[model samples]
Target: MYQTKTKREKIKLFLIILIPILITQVSMYGMTLFDTIMSGRAGAADLAGVAIGSSIWVPVSMGIVGILMALSPIVAQMVGAKQDQDVPYTVQQGIWLSITIGVIVSILGFIFIDPILSFMDLEPRVQHVAKYYLISIGTGIIPMFVYNLIRCYIDALGQTRISMFIILLSLPLNIVFNYVFIFGKLGLPAFGGIGAGIASSLTYWIALGLSVWIVHVVRPFRKHHIFRSWSKPSFKSWISLLKIGVPIGFSIFFEVSIFSAVTLFMSVYSTYTIAAHQAAINFASLLYMIPLSIAMTLTIVIGFEIGAKRISDAKHYAYMGILSGMFISIFAGAILYIFDDPVARLYATNPEVIELTKHFLFYAIFFQFADGIGAPIQGVLRGYKDVNITFWMSLVSYWIIGLPSGWLLANYTNMEAYGYWLGLIIGLAAGAIALFTRMYYLQHSLQKKLDTQQS
Candidate 1:
């Protein structure tokens, strides 16, 4: 739909936002990456502790952050519609929402931590270490969400360089601090895996401080006066955000929790199978951050266009995003498929692990196409404030279609882990089709409205 020039400009704009966001995400993604590695280094118990802590924390933490993601479209729309005055109120409400949820999550996190760990029936030492790690990181939930709110606000305004720079700066800082605390370097007592949590909590404080200072002191944010006046929580505004956010949060939860469940079910498999599965997933997720960054940018851009009532342009840009993501994913998938050997070898030296990783990686590559396609569809849909549909789609595809079929094939049949990946392939592809089809219909209907209005 976009003319060559228009497409080029959108792509350029996409890159401008995408590159910084990519950097920001890569840096942000590294925190978890480093956490996992550091925990592995600490000891087997420490590693299990950190892994369990992550499984419990990540989904809930992501839910809180997902709720705040409504801020992106809200702020971007205000920017696009030139409703500058409304931006502050929307963002302020987001801040209130973040703090409230953060506090609730932190408290709930502490209270539920024991029961959840106990439910898993993990090793006693692993459970003991997991609780301390969680409690340590849990204390920073408020700051973490607050920082996310601030980041979303400015990012929606299309200024990502600052956040990217801050995150890039934070990565090395987190790594150094992680090293110091985990290893007891520089006079600090070694906390081992617990130390990563301590260091992570400290990082959030630093991020929050820098973020608030930038908003208060920076010229870009000063004009908007984001923090100028404190806005009390309004039931009406809160509801509006929740309307958009709750579905997105649960949608993500469904995707993550189902996969988490699959990992548990994988306990029946050999250690090699477990290692291969983890390696494949880790590799896929790292690559996924690429499309994920673009999708995040699209949520802002498409939302801005929608807010401005440039429906056709919105559609054009949306399509462009989807196309670009798919094109790039081809390369990513190819790289993974082509180099499966070296990559699998790097994950482990065991012949069995390496061989299983090779097979898993083969299956993983099949989903990259769907993931590439799905990420942007979700992003563009976000810009249009269409989220509930995705929740339903994900539920049906992953649970009803994918998980059921996989469980049957894996357990009911002899396919084992292969059945799971096969089911995942089917599910992710189904989700991609369902989401993209919905977007198409919405775009066509909007185009018809514009045509009718002109006539």
Candidate 2:
């Protein structure tokens, strides 16, 4: 039977999930923040190289991460429905999916990475380092995806604290690795921008190794007998995961690629422009973690309700999550807007980079509302196994509306960097509206059906 949770109880549960996930995300981004700070210290060219290379790597890797993320809701629902026996088999299938996709992507990313960098309009020096950075990191793609698959399984089991602690551990370890490789500390050779990539590669591996140890040794996971037997890859299981996963992957791809595309467009300007763009966007992403973590938790929470055959309860708590996200956005936006200058100073030392980031930050601040609203709604919908509409909606909002407008404004008008950010505002807003509308309609439709069944 589905256990009923009070409204206050739901909010409390949301907080329990939100804080650890937030720390985990913060720790995850802490790695990037460290890389960005270190890159800035290296040189403008080093910073730009990392930014450009990240533009390529982040989106490509996110596509795989997004697809694998489908595992969260699936596993959450299964656990909720008391199909605990299926969890281990489901994990095996996820591993198979990760390995299959990981091998292909890692190979292609390595072969094509240099050629792609060669075509970009980067400063030759920046291009050279960016190519090295991509290659250094590209080799670790499979391990990273496998780690994410592991993370999904653990988080679905309400063991979020495990992922949080592991990421926290990786932060200091990554810094040490970066120090040794990037600065020739501790008898290591200085690799500069490439060193950060190498550090991240090593960090993912370390974290993965630790995760395996924790799962095997920890008392909680041993109960599942998750590793007692390995299941062969099944085509049917692949199709099942892919059906829900592909759209999610594409949706994230569209969103992240558009942002990455803007970074490429920024390259047309001075190196400082791109560096400043990187700083502002990275800071914006930090604030975005609030809603994003909340969104991730909503999937598990609402999926649990759905699996327990509590549609109304799922819908109720889903709104609570969405509202919480919006509330947090208001505070986060205010903080960014009010303290923009000091925050920009944290990423860069140059006056021009600082000023430019300050100006562009307005759009980033304004869009948080839309991002917050859209993000959690989509998370709830994912729990309901609804993704196709989101994929199509994102394509329209980001590609059709956001990127083109950004390009036109940055190129044709005097907006330049400012224009691209303005386009971000519009794109985020459209996505928010579309998602909200879809959820509203679906909720009422489900309500009517439930009412009829009762009658």
Candidate 3:
């Protein structure tokens, strides 16, 4: 029997694992803030354009990223099973697959940018800006996909510190690029929102290059020969990846589509309302990276533990990760609530925008708790290879319940923006409940299998 860890040992392990995750999240939020700040300064139209462009762009990109993310759990399982020699081949397959998908997505995004912008009914200026941003950013899809593949491989190897290190090193360069590109500094023409997009594209490629160098040429992973020839993509590996990844992709797509749809629906409101909504969302999303990173880490950890057949330990780690997320979110929510005004003011100057944003901030604070709880639970479920339930739950919660509720509340009720926020809260709550229930059932099933085998 495995020995139970002492409380101190548990705490130490948690801290050691959690700190890099926290740093990585903070770095991601820093990047978001940089984007927002540069876009906001470009002009309100530019800000609105980036917001809308990202609403669509992020979901599509994340959907593919979710598919690529299947590599982590699969790799983790291999690692846990002491099949380390196969890791490089798996990583290479993921790299090739992600690049192929990225090319297709890039083509679609470039071709449909104008159509999507027109459909959103953005103001004429906002539409033009958004179109430019989308086109420019679309060029970076391959780099983004490559970066995620590298990140997943590194993370699955339990070297999350590399991601953190890269982010820290790149952030300063990103800020410099943003400043030069956005402001026409050093003889560059001012491209406004397009400049921000260009900077983002360049930054992604730079980061990808650095990551590749680190993984391939650096001391540790260099020995692994990540670039070495692997058995060409097998039908078996592709099927395995698809079986695990499609559900995860759909789950994330469902949740993200609801938000994108909501944003589109809200455009029916005045521009001020949409701006307020975007600002509030920007802040909330920044905070959300914390739980998101933690959830991703837990997914890796739990998958590794389960692959080793340490069933109880896997369950314990997942629960502990959830508890840690909840505690941190509570404190984060309180801080956000207290500083709501300052946060809103940072993004917008209009009194109306500020007022609406404050209301959004209030709701956002409470929503974070549900978000924190839900993300890690889903992560654990994904780690357990139980993504089918996640897909079903997300479809039910977001499409069937969340989207309709938001539309009805926004259109029919006296509370317009608040109604949408309420819908989001309800959706998150439902998602949290469903994910937790699924996780519980998975753990119970695993325990039964273990018992039966022992008997």
Candidate 4:
């Protein structure tokens, strides 16, 4: 419906989409950031405990995120093609899918959490906090999934600000909840690190409630009748979604689980090592929101363009997004390099932890450089529906190449925890190169098709 005939127009529209999404992504991620910061204030043991628990939770939750992300392209294409009637059904099926997966993951999380934590051989206090942390957060899985699905639908329609508004409302509440439950205000016993999980769970439910109300009240969203139109669950529809979604889910799982694996592996080291590693990783994740938001917007913009049969425009958008990501990474790296000490102190008061965190932050600068390029290419590929290859690429790059190399370096050499971060840099660089190559191939192939048709 909007025109993007010139590069200027495209950039303008991209900013329009990118800004709200940036706010939403940052606000949503802010919960985790606050969790780490607040838990760190409680004690090094608590910080390490939440870090361990997050090592378990993030991959599972993010995999679900990737799966539900299929809805973005699905609905974006529908809107672009003016298949308005079909949008509601697809969105509805997505909700059904979310609910089913949420329930299953929650149940499995409760069953497996104790055993997983036990296997880690963490310190007793750390293990107790980790176990109960997972359990507490497990209660919110359903609402989180459902909320994310609705958010995807809204984003695909280019109504990103709605989701932004919803998350903004929830962000403050999360901090308040954390303060209350984490510190044991109002005459309650302090839960220490486990309170972060409890706060996050409550935040999820609140966000979901806000999402439902907003979607029902908002004009274009309500026009789709996502609530009023209910169709019975369709296995065929589920299959179609899984066809696009499962590979994405697994791809994200492969990438994120590498981080979790690193966290678990770091546990064998001293508590200072674990806490420092987590602080660095957490800060890196926060910085990652920039490229990540750009990549997500790329998915929506490029998907809509592809659906509207504007392959040239989609290609242009892809180039713009990937370049912007790289440029931003350079800026971010400079900031991290300059402010490493102050940033480390933000997470911990201990001099040892702070020093170790600075070392890790130095390593993270390289990690972001690779991720800046690789992450957006993944989003562009998703817009083209070229996903299966990404899954294999992630597995090979992260698990096969990255993890083993880090283990060898950490265990066999003097680099220690720093070795693992160097491995991440290598893995991410490899994945970025492979993905860029893939994106290049697809762009030319699509261009040829478009040229032939025009001729």
lDDT of 4 at 237: 98
Candidate 4 per-residue lDDT, tens place, 1-455, comes to 36589999999999999999999999999999999999999999999999999999999999988999999998888888889899989988999999999989988887887788878868999998888888888889999999999999999988888889999999999999889888899888888889999999999999999999888888988888888958999989988998899888888998888999999999999999999999999999998999999989999999899899999899999999999999999999998999999999999999999999999999999999999999999999998888899989999999999999999999999999999998998889999999999899989999998899899
Clashing residue pairs in candidate 4 (N, C-alpha, C atoms within 3 angstroms): none
Q: What C-alpha lDDT does candidate 3 achieve relative to the native structure?
A: 0.81
Report each candidate's C-alpha RMSD, comma-separated, in the order given.
Answer: 2.7, 1.4, 2.0, 0.9
Write model 1 residue lDDT over 1-455, tens digit each, in one string: 11223777878787788889889988887777777567656665665566667666777777678778889998888888888888888888888988888888877776887787777756677667778989998878899999999999878988888889778878888999889988899888888878888888888888888888898889678887878778889989999999999988887777666666676566455544655676666677778888888888899889888988889778888888898899989999999989999977655566776788798889888887888999889889889999999989989987898888888888888888888888887888898899999899888898998999999
Please give the CA lDDT of all the candidate structures. 0.81, 0.86, 0.81, 0.92
RMSD from true fold, candidate 1: 2.7
> Model 1, which residues run further than 4 Å from truth?
1-5, 267-276, 341-359
- Arranged by lDDT with the best first, the candidates are 4, 2, 3, 1
In model 2, which residue pairs have backbone atoms overlapping below 3 Å?
none
Clashing pairs for model 3 are none
Q: Write the per-residue lDDT of candidate 2 for residues 285-403, one digit (tens) a residue.
A: 88888888988888888888888878888898888888888899999999888999998888788898899889878788888778889889988888888899999999999999988
Cand. 4 TM to true fold = 0.99
Instruction: Flag the better candidate by lDDT, 1 or 2.
Output: 2
Supply the TM-score for candidate 3: 0.96
Per-residue C-alpha lDDT of model 3 across residues 1-455, encoded as one tens digit per residue: 01235656555655665677678767756765777768777777777777787778778877888898899899888888888888887888788788888888877876887777777777988887778877877888899888988888888877878888887887887788889887889999987777777877887888898899899887667867897665586667767887888899888888777777778788777777877788888888888887888788887877888788889888888888899889989988997889999998888777988898898899888778898999889889877888887999999988888778877897899988678888888888899999898888889999999999999
